[model samples]
Target: MNSQVFQTPIEYLKGVGTARAEVLKKDLGIFKYEDLLRHFPFKYIDRTRFYKIRDINPELPHVQVVARLTHKEILGEKHTKRLIVHAQDDTGVMELAWFQGIKWAEKNLVIGKAYIIFGKPGMFNGKAQMAHPEIEPYSPEALKGKGNVSLQPGYNSTEKLKTFSLDSKGLQKLVAILLDQFAREISEILPQYLLQKLNLMSRVDAYRNIHFPENATLLYEAQRRLKFEELFLIQLRLLKSKLLRTQKFKGNIFGSVGQCFNTFYHDKIPFPLTNAQKRVLKEIRLDTQRGVQMNRLLQGDVGSGKTVVALMSMLLAIDNGFQTCIMAPTEILANQHFISIKQLLGDDFVEVALLTGSVKKKDRKIIHENLENGKLKILIGTHALIEDAVQFQNLGFVVIDEQHRFGVEQRAKLWRKNTIPPHVLVMTATPIPRTLAMTLYGDLDVSVIDELPAGRKPIETLHFYESQRLQMFGLIKREITLGRQVYVVYPLIQESEKLDLKNLMDGYETMSREFPLPQYRLSVVHGKIPAADKAFEMQRFVKGDTQIMVATTVIEVGVNVPNASVMIIENAERFGLSQLHQLRGRVGRGAEQSYCILMSGGKLSREGRIRLDTMVRTNNGFEISEIDLQLRGPGNIEGTQQSGVLDLKLADLATDQEILLQARKIVEDIFARDPQLALPEHQVLHYAFASKNAGLSWDKIS
Candidate 1:
């Protein structure tokens, strides 16, 4: 490409001036000629087939017609006035109306003259009508010049941009001007061999057809080429990061499976490891032993025994004469992990300590001393572990639970603790879809423990309407009588006029009335409650002192009570699929058959029904995640929306998996043949990669 021509500011364009350039930049992020060139249309409309007046229907998305205007009039008073025009074909007549721009339409439209009209067809008062339709003077020469193309590109514009005459049509006109002037300046970025092997279109032709195609076949080819390049560049950058990290950063060599790991595996383990768990462990072992810094993401569903795998990985570090730490997002989670790890060690001799903001000043001093003196082999805590005062003697491995909750800079702090950054294993209970895993954590290796431990049964999920409240209450009572606890979760802390869902306080009051205090004890927790009070309530529930625990989603993570056999989510339709799944996982921890009762009103939206049906259908987290990705696009998924890496203009992770996989495979093959891109044919590829990644620093990290 001619860099100077492409990088020219938008104001320099023939039609766009300073005022319009500011609006374009602010509304659409179009600053330079290149930015406008890459802005592909969202959809296309067929304009080749002109519809007759009698054939127009509301079911049709849009229609184009060339007809003669015979009648024109203005109706109603100010604020209610509208321009009404009648256009007639040989078969019938249709009404053309405009309310906002009536003056412009009344002056510009010529009666008794032919016009080409295009817009969405609708019906008003049992007659065919079009509101604010596009009108152009009919000319045979203009039609011939357009070549009668079937597809017309439609761009997206904001209301602010529309005020500056930058609507879809305006944007399309600007794109056409740029293409006509600088189409020859656009250069190909892909190599000739790869293009021929893939049968891809040229870069310049793709850009032209993407904005203004002569035919549908050419449009399809243009889309294919552009989507491939977008995904290929992303995959190339990620894979290159992984390659460079492996070659540049040397890791601590854990040469042997020493006594600590062996002892825990043989004796201290409470249950046998599942095949999935073993597989993940093997991957981690290989990564650490290869003498390269390990950055792996461990994805497992709730109660899938990921904690055990994390602990065992830490033990491997201990056997290599190094210290390790586990960081959690919340204090409650950190405390729970500390307790679980302690219980799992049983009679083992590995030293472990808990550190958090709640730890006293004197106690923190002792923990600090032990950490620096190398007495603390393992430390489990919240963000306190990343403090500069909490230095380590020789930290070799680190485990981060719920890794998405922490920012990139926070994780980098742990990396700086050691002269040579420790091997990092970031864990998440929220299962990520395959495509998302490739894009979000592409720089890190991924291992999944896809199976639950033995003796655990899948939770039986049930949906209930408000009319069936009594039946749900009866079931809860039966479970409590059977020596099992219950969890009652509400969506909100207090009542809101906008939403008709039950709140936590109201539900707690009703529960207190339904089951008297002397007969039944209930603990309540929500975000508004004090930290100490929340912990007290949680402790009471954990100890089985309370027969029911009514809380908010704050208990969604970190709380594990085996005896809690029933989970009742009030207004279940208000929660997301992933959140509902996490709440369902709170139960079914014990050998007994557990139940998750989804309580909602009688009416449900389409999306709400799908979410509930999916919960009742399967217990597979991976399957649920895929469905979630389909329902809500990649931008709406939990952690990825803020990453800024998913700002893709053409390729979609939800429906373009095939293209993504092919792009990844092609990128891998290219790297295998030419790691440095030093081949004569790969010069274009190297320059493109370098230009795309200019001034980026994240590639140096995980």
Candidate 2:
């Protein structure tokens, strides 16, 4: 495996000179050859054969045609260099129009000459026409319809690069240079046995085929191999990091059985803790008291008493003469935490303060002074608590709510606040698939609150078609009349015919007219609204002051309105399963029989139908997550299409669950026998593993 870095800048790459490099660097963030090598295409184009002009469909975006040039004419005003050529085959005749590149195109389009043209066909002057189609001079054999382009690579380039004559084919030629020159040095990256068993193509071969495939099977194979490699690297990185943290690092151990927890359990709280809560508390107590830093993920379904458990854990820290800080992703959530903890620990002798980005200067100064002086024993805030200005006297424990919103860097920053890394507890309401959890958070220990609190009923979820709009509105009216608030959510802010559904603004207006709350007040919230305004509107619903709240997914994460027993998701099919679960969670937090009405306005795709059906069939977040994983795959779970979280080349995170389990077993055995993969039989694997991690800042494959 080649571990050496390529230091050459992009300009020095075979075809991209200084001018082309300038365009790439300025427009696409490509400053080096390495960047170009890693810039994977978003999509591909297939040009197997060209169709006759008469067979063209104006509605289609991509089309190919082959015909002979029968006539050529330059028309339009002096300022317009429009060249029009009439071409025809046995089927029909069509016009070829080139607006500016007349001289060059005309020279290539001689009368009686045959050529192949590839581009979108359109209607002009009530006839078929192709504008600036990619033209290729015909060969005698190709003119007979025998030639075919099995696959064509389309490189992602900006307009500036295109105008400069640098297109997909041009970029492909440059990459070919890199691959050809480095073939020998690019030692195979995976073990020979695993590669053969998985039927994955070699890295060198995969790269070539990804850009220029000889057949459909090869293309599929190439894509599968690349996806698997990416995913494998990610899993390896996560597992390796986890091993490093647990095996190499030490943490402050907290004892498992303590009088503080026992006393609080029997004397302090008014109600008994739920079984799930007790189980999670025990796990946290063990992890924190193990004398090693606790990096654990606490996953709970909606209304599973997660907050109470979090509060209990924080109390344990406080009892140990250590200060605890809890961070929520939003100001509203932070404020909610402040109030909940203060109320939960009423007269328990723990100081708590709320710090947010919007804190007034005077209040900020007071909080800052208190935090620095250790007077603020427990702090609850948004990202403001992470700012350097905020100091803790003895920050022993850290709790992060809605942990998915914070990235690795942000969590690390908070973890560094104490002299010793604080016992960290991260919580998330979004239930992730087991495979995804393993890959995304392999470094952290996980705790699942699988059961809801005692006496709590599951929220009833239903799906409604657009035709049932009137009935759904009536249901909401009845629910509001029954003293329960309702949330009407829209996926968009304005009407977009491209996406068949009511936008937030349009829905707000229509809802205002239909569900006229003359006797009841209503509030509106969306992304474009100011945060302060959104927070205020959310407060209205939270306080039971607003009868209905027309909102977007903005409230999908933090806002908790127990009294809002009804959730009417407009265009519910547009939302993902996990998102729907989160929104449904907003309700069902109280002791009410909450209902989630999923309303979709148009025909749902198979996946969309599955999402809505899953929501209606079950209220368990874990089940919904498995459905989501099966439908959407793990591409965007890390939030970005280009994220490097699961950089697998051959493995399918969703479908190959059994394969992953087998691989885990194999990895464990192999490590036990030869920890560094130093055996002769594992040489292929060692090279493959090292090859995958070569040149990467952090090893993707553990």
Cα-based TM-score, every candidate:
0.95, 0.76
lDDT of 2 by residue, 1-702 (tens): 444434368887777788988998887777755566666655667677667777788998788777888999999877876999988889988898989888898776789988777888998877889998877777766544233355667778777878877677667677778767654554455667778888789876776677667777888887776666665545554555565576666776655545655666777776677777888888888888677888888988887778888877877887777788888988778887887777777765567788998889899999889877877778899998888988787788899987777776887888888888888898888887888777666667899999887767788988988888888988888888789989888888877879777888888878888866567688999888898898888887888888889988888877777788899998898998888988988888778798999998677789998899889999889988888888888886635334455655345678877656655555556566765556777655533444343332222234
Per-candidate total of colliding backbone pairs: 0, 29
**lDDT for residue 515 in candidate 2, whole number 0-100:** 68
Instruction: Put down candidate 1 lDDT per residue, 140-204, tens digits, no spaces.
Output: 86475383335788999999989988899899999999989998887777899989999999988
- Shift in Å, residue 657, candidate 2: 7.0
Q: Considering only N, C-alpha and C atoms within 3 Å, which residue pairs clash in candidate 1?
A: none
Top of the candidates by lDDT = 1
Worst 10 residues of 2 by lDDT: 691-700
